[model samples]
Target: MTNVVIVGAGPTGLTLACGLARQGVAVRVLERATAHADGSRGKTLNPRSLEIFADLGLAGELAAVGRTHLPFRKYFEGVFVNETEPFAGARRSATIPYPASRWLQQPQLEALLRERLAALGVTVELGADLVDVRQDADGAEAVLADGRRIAAGYLVGCDGGRSTVRKLLGIPFVGEGDPEPVMVCGDVEVEGLDPGAWHQWFGPQGAFMLCPFEGSPRWQLQASPETAADGTMVPPSLESFQRLADTHTGREDIRLGNATWLSTWRVNVRMAERYREGRVLLAGDCAHVHPTAGGLGMNTGIQDSWNLAWKLGHVVRGLAGPALLDTYQEERLPIAAWTLDVTSAGMAAVVKGIDTPGIGVEVGGVGDFTGLSLGYRWSSLAAGTPAGGDPGALLRAGDRAPDGPCPGPDGAPGRLFERFAGDDFTLLVLGAGTRPDLAGLPGHVRPVRVEDRDGEVRRAYGVTGEALVLVRPDNHIALVTPATEPGPVHAYLARLGATG
Candidate 1:
């Protein structure tokens, strides 16, 4: 029997397999496609998402191949309205190890993840689409397209929006489609222009976005034509793609060459009513799908994998209770909802030619929306979170703390995220006065103090005001109280099956 059977070999499934395999858990990822998924769906990596990859030891590779999308621009009717770079303070505040946000192609990003999983000896079965699934108290079983049966301690569906596992499990995905789907995406080589920077053209012709792909001057184009309804139904042919480009840019001489991958898809803003059922769980597109405006789809899926991987591994290893898995849905579902909201609003603003939506901010790191700086508010562990205020406050016990750099007890420069290296629990202490005596806590719980030697790390966590923030192995905040006694800390761990 396998420890975990993941249905889908996209970034989410591959990432989960990589994380679990690093923790010595046997993971099998099944994909319906005959080979790795190579598409041009999402092209940008939010700063926080890049930090997650850094913890997985792929930051160097990601940084090497990925392009930093500087000078973000907004155009109105083919006219430039405003342009700005990434948050400046974010680059300066890195007591953490990774940069804020960078842009990389989806194919390269997925390839790197698959390579890491392979290096760890995790095998992904391509073309083995999940046809049927069933779960019991002991384990879950999946039927592949070839009529093969695989049993595992748990099964997670990371397949795309049309998820067979999700359908077989009878989970209702509650959401709606974009009434005006104004996004068309495909990868093509431009013959006459240097694809070194990101360019956007807006106006009566709608909006066109082009970004440079790695190792070539070729560009990936995403746009909405004024004549086309919702950027959907454009034929996936070279002639069709060039025609759309011509209509948007009004350049008849532009030839779209090297038509490697092409597809026209509609954007949906939907998520599952619930993310898990018994021994079965959901991640990636299976759990939620949002507009591709903010490039949040793939990143959110990767985050879901990060959230579920550690607990699943621990439960399978008999180190944590099955109840620990409940936190996955509780913690991630909110993010999916919030991301959808942000993307929906932003897309509406962009389409209407609005220069500054509430989501846009200056370069000083005031409003970051990669879901990296977001905190948890609605969990049993986060009982003290302020009610009804802006939910994006500092990290609480049940929220994932933003990662930055910190000095270890050994005085070595360490990242707050490095604690999640290969998956382990972390306890973040704010004030020296409130550092609970953790001598009696479980050995796996890593206690960290953000008391002195910095202001950004201190302010970023809001621990000075709130006291202590307990972070889970998956990086979700587990608790937040104003310098409480050790009782709540001990109680929190016990509830999650942590033993001293």
Candidate 2:
């Protein structure tokens, strides 16, 4: 029996496998596709995801393949709007360390994750699709398409929206809010059009967006009508694309290269009622499906894996209680829901040109929609906050912490996060009050003083005013206290099966 068996080898599955395997957990990933997908569907990594990659020691590698400030270059009716600014000042004063976000294509991101998993001796079984699943108290069994059975302590479904594992488990994805139905998505190389900017023509002709790809900085066009379509478009020959480009952008003389791939589909904002049932759990699109408005699908899914991987590691290794696993749903469900709402709203707002009041009009420098700063407030793990009540005070236990580089112990500065970047449980104390008490907790527990930068840790946790904060293994804040006391801290640890 493997320690874990994951279905799907996209970013979420590959990330989870690498995270678990690094901790010496045996993981097997089953992918239905013959090889990794080469689609350019998802193209942005929110700040939180960049931090998770940093923690996994792949930050430098990820940075190498990614370009910055893609989100900054957004548009409205063929005009430039706002672009993200350099996070220099804030990063210089951060408590936790890392970049806010990096822009990388989906195919490149998946390829890197797969490479990381390979380095850890965890290779995925391509062409191995999950035909059925059976779960009991002892373990969960996965029957593949070829009639092969594999047993594991736990099973996670990171498959796309139409998840076979979710279906086999009989989990119903309840919500569906898809108002704008028409979509025109394709990856093509076009000449004469500006490759530096992402343009959107929002007038009556319909909405169209163009994002630049990594190679040659060519643009990938994504357009939509008021209605959704289920038809596929043949890859346009260079001549054909140029003709279409002329019609859309009004550059008749423009030369368009052959499209790599072209297809169209509607976007939806929906999610599963629950993230888990019995020993089976879901992550990424399987658990929730959000609109591509902010390109949150891949980023959120990567964050989901980051949250669940650590808990699974602990539970499988007998380091944390099974209850710790429950926090995964409690914490991530709200984030997923919020993401769906925001993205759905953003898409709707764009389609109808509804002005979001008091939320600012631009996207960079104080006006941007910082997808990385999300925090959780409602869960047994996070005590007392509006979202989770007093029980959710731990920042947003089981949630992702936004990135900000901080000073290191050495005279030279480093990230406030470097201490906990080793894939272990981290305890962040914003003040000196609880550092000494939380110290000497355990080998897995590392405590850091959040003094160099005020509001740095707070911002990362999405806590407006809180002194002491405890983050979970997955980088989510677990507790927040006006004062640091050992009792609640110990209780939190004990709940995770941590011992004195």
Candidate 3:
């Protein structure tokens, strides 16, 4: 039996498989689709997700294939209105290395994740549709469409909105749906349009957007259809898309052809009441489905898998108690609900032709879209703020551990993130003194001493002379305390059952 069975071979499931397999846990992925998908469904990878990819060593690869900077150009009936750069003026800082979101198609992102998983000696099993799932104390068994049963210690549903695993577990997906103003989205090859900027057109008919896909001739097309009295949507077709383009842009000269994929989307905002039911759990679209305005759907799911993978790794390896798994739902459910509201507001603005920027207008600034501000400060695992430090400091016990340049043991230049690349907790000691007594440290904890020559790391962490910051395997700060008082560190670990 495998250690974990992941249903649906999307970005979320594939990421979980890679994270678990990297830590020597056996993972089996089931996909209902016979082959990989195409088209640019979710194209934007926010800054937080980019940081996670950097930890996975795929940041450089994704950056090479993605477009990092694209301005949004608005047009009124084929007449230029105003242009705005959503990611403009964004610069990388010592703490935040990736400050900009990336534009890469979902298919490409999933392919990269699958490649990484294959390197770890795991492959996604295609054409294995999950029909039902049953769980007991020992383990959970998944029944496939072919009447084959597979047992695993845990099951995660990363399947899309129509999730069989979630349904089999009887999880309630409660939310509201918008009946009017349905959107037709797809990828198509077009002529008479410059591939320089993301083109948006507003007219009496409705608003339509054509964003150039990175490294491809095809562009992602999105258009809001006219309201139907009976709330019926026209099936996606090449002719229908062309008609939309002509009607919205008032330009018949622009030709649309070679449609690769097409689908109609409505604003269906929802969240699963519970992320986990016994040994079966939900992640990604299975747990939460929101509007596509903020482009947070896939990015949020990627983060969900990242957060759960380390906890599952520890529990499966016997380094932590099974109760640690409960924190996944506790920490992620609220974020999902928040994202749904933010995206729903953005969608409302879109319907009103407000030309809202990426990440929503109600949120403070563009940084909010990067997801850097997202943290689990209220989580039960995060503990102990720094002593004598300002309460308003950017770095906190539950915030993301910032990255900075640091010196390695051999005096070579290295990064703080290198310590967190693996499946182990990293303890950073910022001071010039000798390393503290780590004899009581658990085997899963890796301690590194930083000299803090120029105090760049110190400034980023808001620390004074000497401090110890315990970073979890997911790169979130777990504990912050003065070097003199290391008892809280041990106590925090004990709460999570990290100490053996």
Candidate 4:
């Protein structure tokens, strides 16, 4: 029996599989599709997801194959309105190393993740659809389409919006769908169009958009029909796409060529009432479905699996109790709810003409979309109080651990992120303080004492004196307290049963 069985070999399932396998946990992945999915549906990878990829050693590969610094050009009634690169002004700061988002076709991104998982000696079982699932106290067993029963300690549904696991679990996905202004999107080749910019056209007819997909000759084509008889959407086709372009842009010079993939999308905003039911859980589109306005669907799913992987690993290893797994829903459910609102609001703004195309649609600013601003301040795992005093102090428990330059083992220069590269809790000790006793610490927790030589680490962590910051396996700050008082740190771990 495998330690965990992940359904849906998309980005979420593959990411979780890799994370758990890296920690020496046995994981199996299943996909209902007979083959890998292909498309540019979710192309934009936010900065926070990039950071997670960096920890997994795939950042370099992603950056190499991804496109960045592309400008979004908007036009109205065949007249050029304006152009702006939302992330152009973004610069890498001391704490935030990656500030720009990258665009890579979803298929390419999934390929990279699948490659990494293959290296880890795990292969996704394709054509193995999950027919049903049943769970008991010890573990869960899944029924496949071919009548094969596979048992695992845990089961995660990463399958898309039409999640069979969610339906079987009977989780209520409550929300409303936009009735009007349906969109048809697909990958197509075009002539007489510059691939340098994300082109958009909003006119009396409707809206049309074409974004260049990096590492390919195809562009992602999205358009809203001006008129659908009886509110019926037209089937996706090259001719239909050309008609949308010609109608919206009022130009016949541009031509649409072969199409690789095409599909119709409607605004169906819904989220699962809960993320987990006993040993079975949900991730990605299985848990939440929202408009693709902010390009957050896939990114959110990636983060979901990343967050769950560590907690699940701890439980599987017996280093923590099963209750620790509850934090998965506790920390991620709110985020999913928040993201839905953001995207729905963006859609409403577009409909009301209050927001410009590709601008002001993000949940916050560009920083927020990068996933860095997301934190679990209310999570049961997060514990600590701000030291209070420095007005610039921002570090707190349940926040992302800011990356900064620090002293290395030989008193040379290193980075805080370097210390948190592994799937272990990192204890970052700032300034000259008595190192916390690690002999009693759990084996999953790694302690690294850094001399705050230039006050860089101290400033980043908002610590004036000796302090200990407990960084979780997922790189979020779990506890922060003065080194003299390590009781809270130990206590926090004990609550999760992390202390051996």
lDDT of all the models against the reference?
0.72, 0.69, 0.85, 0.84
> What local lDDT score does residue 97 receive in model 4, on the 0 to 100 scale?
80
Mark the regions of model 4 whose C-alpha exceeds 4 Å error after superposition.
Answer: 179-181, 226-231, 354-367, 388-393
Q: What tens digits encode model 1's per-residue C-alpha lDDT throughout 294-330?
A: 6677888988888788888888877788887887888
* RMSD, one per candidate, in order: 4.4, 5.1, 2.3, 2.2
List the candidates' TM-scores in order: 0.86, 0.83, 0.95, 0.95
Q: Which candidate achieves the best lDDT against the true structure? A: 3
lDDT per residue, candidate 4, 44-133, as tens digits? 888889988899889779878868788878887667787878788989998888898888888888899988898988998999989999
Candidate 3 matches the true fold with a TM-score of 0.95
How many backbone clashes can be found in candidate 3? 0
Candidate 1 residue 199 Cα shift, in angstroms, is 2.2
lDDT of 2: 0.69
**Predicted structure 4, TM vs. truth:** 0.95
Flag regions of model 1 displaced more than 4 Å: 72-90, 94-99, 178-183, 225-234, 354-368, 383-395, 403-405, 428-437, 448-460, 463-469, 480-484
In terms of lDDT, the poorest run of 10 residues in model 1 is 357-366
Better of 2 and 3 by lDDT: 3
